[model samples]
Target: METLFDSACRYMSDSELIYEITNNKKLVTEAERQGGEYDLNGLFSSLTPGRKKVATAAIELYKRLQSRHNGQDAIRCSQDIDALIHPFLWDLPNEELWVIALNTAAKVIKKVRVSVGGISRTAVDVRLIMRILVEASATQFAVVHNHPSGSKHPSREDENVTERLKKAGTLFDICMIDHIIIAGDTYYSFADEGRL
Candidate 1:
């Protein structure tokens, strides 16, 4: 039976095929030496241009499929919000603020990354957030950001931002449902704690 690599080798140039075989051998050796941990980035970076394009396209396809799968459910709780936003924000080395615009039934309309900041904090523009909600015609929304430091506690800045969003949402008759802080595997929810 032909192996997957054998099948792949049929499509590669002679030089590319040799490089892949050599790289795989080196990666297997390194994995064994490192107790089964291998450099995935190294493996990806070593792929031929065509293979890299295919890999990237495959990844984007997976994300779209996963998003569509998750988007069908109405967000009923903070955990739901966490689940939706975690894949985007969690494990980031820096901070990014995102807003999830929700329809009347709490299904997601759109999720937009509003800002990217340093390791500790990110600034959010309430006007921009509102504009996105308006554009989506969302009646409810949530704010999400990650704490790279792994602190689930909301900072004073977090509190202030939440209050500002809440007030602004009121003005437009759009409800601010939750503000979530993703810290590693844990999370903080303003609505869960009666802070929203």
Candidate 2:
């Protein structure tokens, strides 16, 4: 019977082994030698299980350091909006309503999934969306949902919901910036079309 170390060696390359252990593919190649082979059994046996914990701690520390200098602020235009939401909705088969709460600076504070429904439609709870905005201390928000049918045009229900949310947002001094419908790689924005 093959040992776990032997199996790992047979199944994974040096870079893959390092990535499995470190979860950092960027560290796979070094200046000295590209993906230089190491003694897998020796490496595993000599180290404590705490190596993974150490790596996790290091990653967390790095993220904290980067956040201080990161410019993860508000959207500047339709392109920014597309970049923010397309990844989440592009491949979904059913409809999902995502409400993004934004601060006074228009920076995203939180993204809440108001509802998820059938292939064509998902219910949007205005109260829940408003509650999320209030809880996040958001001054504005944008609504996004996917059309698995590959049509970017808004349905009658979509227009009605947008109107209702606009009214509710105005009442609470919160602005509804846009209603975006995404289908595959394309998107339609109500604000850009002068609907919002």
Question: TM-score per candidate, in order?
Answer: 0.77, 0.65
lDDT (Cα atoms) of all candidates against the true structure: 0.86, 0.79
lDDT of 2 by residue, 18-69 (tens): 6667554445554115438555554444444687567557555654444333
Instruction: State candidate 2's TM-score.
Output: 0.65
Would you list the clashing residue pairs of candidate 1? none
Off by over 4 Å in 1: 1-23, 33-35, 38-61
Model 2 bad stretches (over 4 Å): 1-71
Show how many residue pairs clash in every candidate, following the order shown. Answer: 0, 0
Candidate 2 contains a number of clashing pairs equal to 0
Q: Give the TM-score of candidate 1.
A: 0.77
User: For each candidate, C-alpha RMSD in Å?
Assistant: 6.0, 11.1
